[model samples]
Target chain A: MIHALRISLAIIALSLLASCTPTTGTKIAVNQSEISKIKSIGVLVKKDEDFSVRLSREEMSNTGAAFGLIGVGIEAAVRRSSDKDKEEQIKPSLGNFDPQAPLTERLRFHLQEGAIATSEVTDGGEKTAADAILEVTVRQWGLRRCPGPAPEVVQAGFNVNGKLYRASGHATVWEREELYLNGDCRPWSMFRSEELANDILPRALDALATKLVYEILYP
Target chain B: MKRLIRHFIFALALGLVLSACVFSNANVNLAYKPVEGSKSPLSTVKPLKIALVVEDQRPIAERESIGNKRNGYGSVTAQVKSNSDVLTVFSDALKTELGNNGHTVVADKEPLYDVMLRVQLKRYWTDSVIHFWDVELVGTINSDFVLGKRDGDKPILSQPGQGTFRESRQFVTDSAYENVLNGALSEFVRNFSRDPNIIKALQQAGQTATPM
Candidate 1:
């Protein structure tokens, strides 16, 4: 009987630990390039509604001082996991592209380095004196917590859809949609008010921009 | 049961202390002025009398602090907010930069100018994130400029420019995010003035202007 009880307690502890862990989503893929022959590119970043951090029902229910120490430990674990992910997944793929700049600036900076002149195109009506126009639409651009009843994970990333058009004819030459997630898991990791305006979001954005730039320049 | 209570209290105290130590509220102001250019590119040509109009349509230029919101016991995270008049300050900065560039900048609705420069602020914000002991401030601004002869006149040059400035500094007591914003504004103005299209538009407007 005592052995059975011990096993039950061990299982409970393990389950609790699992519930505190963070979870990550899949990495984005680089699509075929369409910007090779284009000498000048006009970038347009469409305005979207503000994005906020979203929490799941599980995160909402798992509250109170009883789980306080465990929550802190879980947060620390999540941070460590995020750092590890950054080192292993993000840095290796992105290489030298910096995440500090906005998507438009980064694109311009990278394209300019490759001898391609870049101009910003605002409002659809303005004349874009470039060979092609790159229209960027940000569907989701913030941090999101995994909606779950199991392992806890938070993702900081963006979902972007891009279309490149030939300016002379205004015809779409290339279209791609990408979702990049940088997340970490911890058991019972229900942090109520974590700041999402951090390096991770920018890094995720940088990753997306890098992938797009790669496809544009090399493809 | 007593031990559980003790642990809970300890955790709560720890969480509160962590939140208190890290969270802050700062009011950022972009107070930098642009230096006048000694050799304006438009020096040889007749200085075009231009109307400078700034439009700021952003809803709010501030990110509010997210205080400790307890989900369950010790799961509290703190967030800092920095608020400022981002649009007004940026317009002032741009005007100073234009005047420094040796352009006659007027703020009138009368159609009495050679060309009109309409600048619209699309986005301006500072994203401040705490990483370990340092706070990273990423300042970004996007503005659209339309240079036309009058309100309904065909635009000579219509372009949008964006600037991103980043700074990571040790979390200090004083407000340093303002410097990052100012740096971004300065870069924006500098880039705008040097844009090949913008320079060309000014020169062309000077050559085509009806003599007063």
Candidate 2:
């Protein structure tokens, strides 16, 4: 009888385990109807903001001097400052911009391109066009620190916040932040910085496109 | 033998529970005009195609879960949902509102359509203490004109919203999801339909109506 009871319970348990299934279903995040309406109502990019070109007398005179003496150092710093200014131009005083790769591409809205120009005269004979002008007043733009730790774990003799420390007796240098001669920030190089900026500008444009679409369609 | 059997059962149950919670933090749902009325312009216009892209990296399942928790006034759970889902719902609600007002609606995959809508959900973060999801939704409309156009066409409309949703609510209570979606849609549609060019186009089409 004991053996029989054990077998019965085993069968019941097996069946229950087999029946277990993950929760699943099709949830339409955005249905067909909604997609259609937006497509029909085209979105326009906003006008680019007027950036006041600011330069110190020394910096202005150097036009070539900063690049000449510092090599790429001065250029990088100026670029960073200019980038900050450009970032502000894209932000809106109120509301928000969309942040998606695909949707942004579809709408062709971009920050670098600025908001859609609503005031531009269309070919149509109508005096006032566009149902409502979407004015995107940018508040914040640019690369902000993405928080969290490194994706991988690093260990050495002594564990110090994912860094490894070596004793004085060690012959070879340990690959660690404190042990490294240079800091986390890369040495300023114009060639490399320009390359990076090229990549970033397009991405910013992509993000801009996303933001522009959201403002127009949802405005 | 008894011990072995009990052990097996416990292990099985444990596995099932783990899988259930793997991506259990979200939900999604659609909200349109509760009933058709004068505001439904989409009923007259042919539906177009639009694609909604959610910004966050979460799987589609969690995104849907977040969307399902919305209400007319917008609920806390709805806000707790992901940013992408929130934008998805808002854009759809806006479209529905536009449709109700007599604009034709279509699918995003379809070509040769009148308008194309692209929406992006951005900056979605949740505050566990208060149980709220802070989000910004960005929307844009794209239109192409083959003739009499400048610079190869451009976007027709762009809009964005910064809104907040509470984390919890009574089972029967309405939340911010509904309120924001409804409000945003109303604003977008009213402005879209009132455009003089759009109105003129529609009027011209109406006048030229001959058996197609």
Candidate 3:
């Protein structure tokens, strides 16, 4: 009887652990054979407009929802104040942001950490020369107020679309257009505005940069 | 008895804990925004009685979806579709723009029309391709219009009305999709009506109906 009880408890515990864990989608590591073909890689981000981070209330409304009509105004008020605070924190970073800086910086850092030599492909570098150049065209980017991993919680959402091309021969290597929807389970968030600007938003960008490099290096 | 009670409690707790992972599907609807139609009617001495007929030549009636988002385990979290009759919406937009510009809008078989304009729609699609982090909602409308006698084999004048737009947003909603697509439609109607050639063709058609 004790053994059966123990087994039941163990099964339940395992199931609970698996379900509650924050998910990191399956990883695709770069094959050494793929990386061997290129000696050095450069990152060139193409952007014609200035970078800006906007803090706006989510457009999600409960006016037509089946329930919860009473709490809508209260929720909106709370969200508004939260946005006001979060906007103040993110303002400094939003203004005069160089679109190329983070991706290039993170790419260089990762390359150096892996002992791989990667350079920045500046404007007009495509004509100059390079072994391999990852031309990143930032089509769209912004910050959002969205639901986090759990209910009744809000997170500062950093959204971006990084379109990449292996520009040495100008052949397309990797291109994934980002069509975003809110309420997806994202791993990044912080409650405080200070942490959001100082940590969550930056870390999200860092992860975004890392993913771009990973895909290019692998592809 | 105590062990049974314990088991029951554990099961209840497990159910409560796992239920939080239940993600509701995102249902979406798309429509065109009521664009402030063409401000200035085509420059003409008299208000043209235009009977408009839009002939759809697109490959599909409905547009391709804005795609879907899946969780780590591969269950669908959200999906977006082009939900409405695009032809009807586009027809209404054209009518509004034409009327706003001082033209008397009429049906295809109207006997009082000074000109019969047949719009040949070639391509129209509105979709956002990704569901990951950031997204761009894109809309495109392409059509070539012909003006001549009702049963004429060839058109007197052929001109294309095309509008393509791209908007960046944090997350896309049904209303957001509608707004972007409407923006594209607005541009299309505005450009189509503003063309001086269509007006000139109407004037010239009053005397002559030669094919272009």
Candidate 4:
């Protein structure tokens, strides 16, 4: 009996010590009613002087800046396992950020698949057929703020703002400012803002679409 | 039987510990900051306020455990890593480099900044047959669309890199990714910085690039 008891206790201790702990969180989402509202609205794209309707390829090109950055480097950095991971473990987070891609691609990836007609066209001094042109005038594309890893949270926020207009008559229809927040899982795993942007951008775009739908249809 | 059981338990404990450590190392979190161009300094005609939107919709991990020639007879276990993480790796690198360059990175809502910089990855993938990873970035600058502004004036940059992940696998000690990342970000900063308007705007606003 005593031998069996010792073995059971040893097993329990090992079980407790051997387990791995992981961090968890959900992507931010908007209200269901808002989603339905955006889907209902249909605005025509203005072809003449319709810069706002199409996200210009030039305006879209700045997304490359995220690739060339380097510093203390990722070697010493520690990070936490992203919620996307199957088996989570903490490691150093990467802190660099790309200002362009998040707002355009993340938003387009989800919203483009929706009911509206979407296409990537090159404007060679001619107008094309489409409803309610979306002129995405990205005033700035990059990290608006970069806070280092800390006992304090390494908060990183990215901003995307521009206006949308009617493509046919070239009248301003909608304008918006988007802000995204993410970072600071733990003290040692500082500077995961770039990693955080992956989740944050998609979430922000979802929210922006919700707002856009409401403004276009309800307003 | 007793001796066999003892060995089994010891081996299990060791396996668990080693697996946890290996997994912990695999989860790499990266932040990308853009640095100023070494050859071409940044010139801005107007102050800029920028926002980044990343479309990170990666497919769920599809694990395939089948006998493959690479591992001889052992099962080749592969799971899909999120594409968002890959984007994050490059994005963080740009953020850091740009921060090192002397420019105020506006990541929040501010009216004073005049132009917006946007960065994005249209597609990224690794083809096992060719053993190559392809990365593409789309970058653009949106000036305050003053009425009747010409379309072609907008600053645009696109850079794509295809490199062998296997050649660098041996030397890759966490720092291997930097080479690829730097290649992508450098192209972006260089192209945009050459514009005289970008520099003029920076000087006019008295905006100094903040340090990381």
Candidate 5:
């Protein structure tokens, strides 16, 4: 009886292990009817602070165990210092590098391509006008040497939270937090660091916004 | 049950204390730092023109993340991964090391070459699992290497190398992990460099080699 019980438990354990599998992402949610109503969107970007490039989080290290909160406090400070080091490394590349103008331009271009009229709307939601509002908060965006599967490999990354709402009724039609790195992909070379910072990073982010808008408005 | 719960709590606290600087889901840059005192074998060997090919056979998930600080129930609290592709980094390192040993490492497969070596990574991973005030940082690499003539016939030599490192640590650091991973890779590749069979094969192949 005990042997049978053991065999039964082993089968159950094997079944549990075999059942573990990773699922791919679902197809983009397309509400065709809702998208049809969103003919025009006013892009509202919430940028209150300066866009500064920082190193990937793993670059920061607190190498030892913390004792009694004080150690934790010191390690935090050191880690912050390491975190801020990349901005200085890329200072030469940051010559007037701004993502705002280009991001809006790309949005307009994509939205128009999607056949939805698009315009820039300032913070005063009540004052300005478009059919709907596409408010985006760029949670994180910029270029850095990717925290690697290889070191000093340049990669541009972005995480954006977006919401599309009707201006008249303010009903949320679409909302999503989109974007992340899939692998330590090397899309650019080190010698082109300047081009990446000045041109590629901004362009990459513009496309990110454009893709989000593409998904929402194009169904 | 109470004692188990108490131990779990202690483990959680210790984990938090140890991983105070850990960045969850972060990629670590395993930059090229040569392993110290790793040159092995006292046998004299001839340097021959070599071709190197490295295949990474680790699962996609292992390629992405090798280690995690998981909750007792097995949810990841923190994760670590290599900042770059493993194949490229490992291949480049092996190539450089070969070059250092006076061997010309090349990409060409023409009859001009002597021996072509293929290194397949069977398993490569690292982890820092915390439990009951014990923090263990572990790095492992298992490799299968084969050496054959430029004729691409039967292989002259085939061997396996495994490198592992585990240490009780206060925490896992970027530098510490880098060193351990490098050590594991160095040790794995040393099988090719340090093995007498491989050495004798390379020398004999060199003597008969007709490089154009």
Candidate 6:
């Protein structure tokens, strides 16, 4: 009986470990020659909304209520408190975390790395003196639960949509949407969601910017 | 048999803890000073008071992964920092070199100069990769330069002159990385001052009077 109990526990732990493993998916296309022709590029980011995690208490409560939970209101309240605790723990490290700044910087770095000059351009503002302009729209960002069990494993990811335009004629030269995922099974990830977001989000952005530059320069 | 199993488990836990402590943060400054005693070929071509336009749009801090990854363990990363404005540093370095070589370098809105020298930074970083026995540091600096008259936007030397400098060094310490960067900067100064096209532009600017 003792041997059987130990084997059962080991199997359960192994299964949980497998479920928490992270995975990524991406699709990108570009015209290498046209992108390489651009000598100096200006970057502009659209500020649509603040970044928020997808699997928040509000989203979960809505889903629970849709499924007609027995005590939906109380359950939501509990989840909200739990998430608030996690947020408080992550608040110290997040010193003025402007989601747009990091993404813009990464894009500029990669552009310069490819021997192309870069400058910042305002959206709907005066035209810059660059050969081409890159417009970025951050569609989705934050930490969310990966598809799995009740104690669902969480992952940090973001979706970036970018369009490159010729400065002279404002014609779309190259376009791509990149999705990045970093699903490492961190210890106590649920309780440290904010910390995980702070750590992995920049890495995801770096990976996305690298891919974008590769597609544009090398196709 | 039970004692052996307990000891094995204890050793495995100790190894995991030790592996977790392998990662560390390294702060690196990218600031470099101008190399003294450099000769400029345009020194004898007559002094031309030129407006120096230097624009830097690079990030102040850059983070990158440093170590190679193991099968079950992840790679160690480092956050490289530039405490000072890198653009300003490069600009100042160029200005000092020009001033030392008997040329007037001004950074102002006045249109009193003969021509405008615009230097735009493209890429500046120290990339490190772990080799079999040591780490290799590659320092790179790339910029786009345009020397043109104040009245028109067209470049006098050419459309835009591109200058790139790279230097590599093998080291285990972070300070050696800075030396590599300084070497690249010194190379840039030497190449920019000796370019034949740039000398021709300076000579033309010195011959022509101020535009009305």
User: What DockQ would you assign to candidate 6?
Assistant: 0.02
- Docking model 3 quality class: incorrect
DockQ of 5: 0.02
Residue A61 shift from truth in candidate 5, angstroms: 6.3
Cα lDDT tens digits for candidate 2, B17-129: 75443233342232434333343323334433323222343345444433333222222333334334455555566566555555454554544344444444433332221
Once fitted onto the true fold, the runs of candidate 4 whose alpha carbons sit more than 4 angstroms away are: A1-219, B1-26, B29-40, B43-76, B79-89, B124-212
Best by lDDT: 5
- Model 2 misplacement above 4 A: A1-219, B1-30, B34-36, B40-91, B108-111, B123-152, B156-212
TM-score of 1: 0.42
Chain B TM-score, model 4, reads: 0.38
Docking class for model 5 is incorrect
- Candidate 1 Cα misplacement greater than 4 A, ranges: A1-219, B1-24, B36-45, B60-85, B129-135, B172-174
For model 5, what is the alpha-carbon lDDT of residue B67?
A: 60
The superposed Cα distance between candidate 2 and the true structure at residue A161, in angstroms, equals: 52
How badly does each model clash, as a count of residue pairs? 21, 100, 1, 104, 10, 0
Over the stretch A31-99, how does candidate 2's per-residue lDDT look in tens digits? 223333322222222222322112121122223332344533455466557645533543332123232
Superposed model 6: Cα runs more than 4 Å off: A1-219, B1-23, B31-35, B57-76, B130-134, B159-171, B209-212
What TM-score would chain B receive for each of the candidates shown?
A: 0.72, 0.36, 0.67, 0.38, 0.76, 0.71
Complex DockQ per candidate: 0.05, 0.02, 0.01, 0.03, 0.02, 0.02
Best by TM-score: 5
lDDT measured at residue B147 in model 1 versus the true structure, 0 to 100: 89
Per-residue lDDT for A40-75 in model 6, tens only? 989887656544444455234233333343344555
Look at candidate 1 and tell me the lDDT of residue B68: 24
Candidate 1 per-residue lDDT over residues B112-202, each given as its tens digit: 7888988877666554433333334555566678988887789998866655555654332224446555656755664565454576788
